[model samples]
Target chain A: MPPDMPTEPIRRRIALTDDGPILVHGPIEVVLTDGKTMISDRAVTALCTCLRSSRYPICDTSHRRRVRNVTARGSGSGMDRGGRGC
Target chain B: MLSSTSPRPVTAPALPAPRGPLSSAVLAALRGISAAPHAAEIPPGAVGQADPYGEDLQLALYCCYELHYRGFAGVSDDLEWDPGLLGLRRQLEQVFLAALGADVAGGTDVAAEIGALLVEPVDAAGVSHHLRHAGQLWQLREYVVQRSLYHLKEADPQAWVIPRLSGPAKVALVSVEHDEYGSGNPDRMHARLFADMMTELGLCAEYGAYLDAAQATALAEVNFMSLCGLHRRLRGGLIGQLVTAELTSSPASDRLVRAMRRLGCGPRAIEFYAEHIEADAVHEQLIRHGVIAPLLAAEPELARDVVFGIQASTLLADRFADLLLSRWAQGRTTLRNPLPELSHRR
Candidate 1:
């Protein structure tokens, strides 16, 4: 490592909201436990908390509703992820 | 900013041909040899008589606003602040504001408004819904062309309000603006991505290329942004417009990505909406809690303006969607002129 380069892991601010995605400031790539990596190049990115998102790691606004109707037909994915669209 | 540099020269688009008497008058002034037209007062109430949402007024107003964004080819850039053009623009804005103010039911309940926006309408009949279900490639192309009027210059109108804001509200708005500007990567800029999609779809990607084909409804959406963002009094209105866009963009963008994939479009075509789905999702949250909350907390009085912004934008969006859907229902083109037929190449 270069002498000027800090040998410490930089502490970053990640805001955890009461409900909805956990907000991380600046671009980040999350390596999930399942070994799938999700990279978001945005200045800020949202990680869905509800587990209903078809986009998985990143929030696709699936968590907006109070309770997404269980039997709703379209998830905007047009791809049925098993039982229900929502 | 993107590390790699491009060789091609970036230039402003040419002035569009006029649609009517009012637009013709604007075009004449812009194309003339003089930097600013000699101050000649027109007949009283001449502007008020023009339809608020008509093509003539919309296009005329668009030309004035365009001077601020990217001056038309061969037109004087100095005209952006020219008194004669500014005077004409003010008259146009008054007619538009009066009409919109009368049409929408105004309120200061920003929380309730944002809550309503969060819910996706089950029985929605919007253009995005139609596209997601069963819209043709040509129709989609035409839709993209009309939208390019604004998307080609995305984030620019809203940038005007930055100077008008301060404290946490200012910081929050700038945070979102930074993302919209591609978080320091110029190549990833939303406008560039939109242009990439246009090229992939075999449509002209040049800015203002489709201005002539854009109807009154399309121009009204962007005009509203310019109108609100330019006025310090309408800062709340600008935030309202931004809120509506960020809140609604994700779902609609998801549908658009599906539509593009369903039509077997190329990667570039699909990439634009795909990026929006993720980007706008973050933006939605930032706009609601970051920008709006802090703004209203500082100045509790701007609530009515905020409501007016949301309601006016929503009405305009519905009008735009209705126009496209109705035209497509009749098996007709939504544009004033049909798009140039796509050239086939491997």
Candidate 2:
């Protein structure tokens, strides 16, 4: 075990593993097979917050829609003000 | 919890200690080699009894009903179809459903009933209200554990009516079901989300873990689900139950979400309620405008049963709420026994 290894890795059975960055959320610590390690906040996605692009889990056009939605809802409001569905 | 391929299909834990003679007979029959032939014998005045919420009778009926859901751990799953047990279950149902029929006044207007359901109770002194205010995490966990009996396989009880329904009603119900089933995304399934919350809260995620400890009120509530679900004739009742649930769920769910966050629970623990806050709000509208509207529009006769379903479900819910709140008022745990003494921090 590496000295800096995460003590508690987020555990979920892999349902699908494609050629894409795996998104981990909520108190996660990832340990790659080659001993690389990473820790994350509760909401972090793999290199992309916007759910866009053909290569999902990676940013594409989806991020733009998300950015606008965030703005429409007002940044940092935490409440989706846009009444898309009531 | 066993996977499909597993050789050992998980069984329900053994019947809890019997509450009365009715439960005793029911449990004995469930555990015995051959069911006692007197399965049809009704406790004197079982039907007309003023307090139809008798723990003994209710628990017995619940046990008989549980066979249809998850059979007890040591009990044979085949008992689910045992004729004697079925006969017993039917008798119990007749008594219980008859009581509900008599008590819940028949409503010719289903729309009025559905509309009435959408109206949230003000100053509703229930678990959700408690949770939204001073409810501690342990209390919330206990409540969820009690709720596990239902949420673990939500939408299943109502699923019985899918085939019974046609046209718009069926499509709308299925639409709601699709979401409940996670829209082909297993990770997003509501039941899965609930289990995740259980795990996050350090409760046993195994289905039915607390069956032995769940009081008769809790058991009766889920048993009502099974009663309405399993009977083809009770499809309207089931839909009524479903409507009541979806309609009332959103605000309660919002309160639960706030409760989880106030207690400083993490995202996984809060996600179940958070998801329901939106999902059930949409489901409420769908059930009202989509399902019930078309359903009663087609078969207007079902309105009576629909009323029965709503009233029966509400009665059971009130009983459950009383059990919990009364227990809490006495500074006691609502479970049959308090969970193993683990001091829950925060």
Candidate 3:
């Protein structure tokens, strides 16, 4: 390491929620699997973890559970596959 | 050289016409025509007998709170602190607060309350849902007008609690507020965005332009924010209101964005809700983890008040939504003054 450079690496903290997004302290540049990059300059950014968000790479709160009544018959699968139908 | 047009002119809103005796008296006091009623002058039974959520009480309270934000065009600025007005405001607040306290099932389980807010009912009948699925452009326009009462001055009411909070909670809350204020960019401010959307929708974008048209239900919703915000003791409740707004806004905003697009609305009209889709998604996390956690840790006693704020605000929101939905169901205009028909702009 060069003498002019700091000896310690600066650490960035991110928070994980069980039912929601991963909150990363931003301005962060997120690169997707297809090699496309998106940047969020917000003070904090919520990266979608559920893959259900309409605004992919940013959570639009699509992770929230949709409650269907017991008698309601359809695809009983819990996750909404139609991308929130907004 | 840049042209020197002012970005936003500082025109105070016009005074709305009085709804009833209480609002008439309050307006008279604001106009400096008659002295505000002394405590004894108001019959003790008058405020008690008035429906807590009725036009008279809600309008009176709204006028009083308006003094703090931007005093009406002709109203004297000094009257904001007038003892008589304040006294009447206090009586009005007592009745309003008592009604809310009686209505809500009070508790201290902030986690449970938040958890419940997170679940979306599959068959939700909220205003946004109606707008997205089955609403017409006129109905959507009316929604904007009623909401303009709050959206035109967004993020202002909750700002009252900033001074009342300490440590990390305050820091987190301010960060969220900074975003609401457009992160130092005036044009991107949420209030500005809302005004732009209103203009795009062919509605008047001026602050308080629709006050006369807005009903008591709409005024009461904004009044509740001002009520909690102005009181230092109600800081926890204010936070509760803030969190509730942040938590629920994202998905609803998404729905509204889709509604606008489906109705052939332009980008300027959809921008406000479109921005909220991501902005509130981030804000929800900040408020829950960054603000609420440390706030409760520092003052656990506030949990009950926070819960009260959440439930009461939710109740008010539901009432507002119900009013709009039911009125729309009858194919009637929801505003006190029906909006003028929009010429074919789409």
What's the CA RMSD for each of the models? 5.2, 12.9, 4.8
Across residues B1-346, which tens digit of lDDT does each residue of candidate 1 receive?
Answer: 5536673466888888887766777888899833443325544555878999999889988999999898899887878898988888888899999999988777777777776777766556678878888888888888898898999898999999999999988888888888777788887778888888999998988888999889999999999999998889899999988888887888888888898899999999888888888888888878878888888889989888888888788778777887888898988888887776742111
DockQ for every model comes to: 0.19, 0.02, 0.23
Error of 1 at A56 (Å): 0.7
Which runs in model 3 stand beyond 4 Å of their true positions? A1-10, A69-86, B1-6, B341-346
lDDT of 1 by residue, A1-86 (tens): 88999888987669776658888986688999899887876778898889988787888888765434323321121221100000
Once model 1 is optimally superposed onto the true structure by TM-score, how far is the C-alpha of residue A72 displaced, in angstroms? 19
Q: Poorest 10 consecutive residues of model 2 chain B by lDDT?
A: B1-10
Model 3 lDDT per residue over B270-296, tens place: 999999999998888889988999999
Against the reference, the lDDT scores of all candidates come to: 0.80, 0.66, 0.84
- Per residue, candidate 2 scores C-alpha lDDT tens digits across B157-185 of 77777888999999978878887876656
Which pairs clash (backbone N, Cα, C closer than 3 Å) in model 1?
B1-B184
TM-score of 3: 0.92
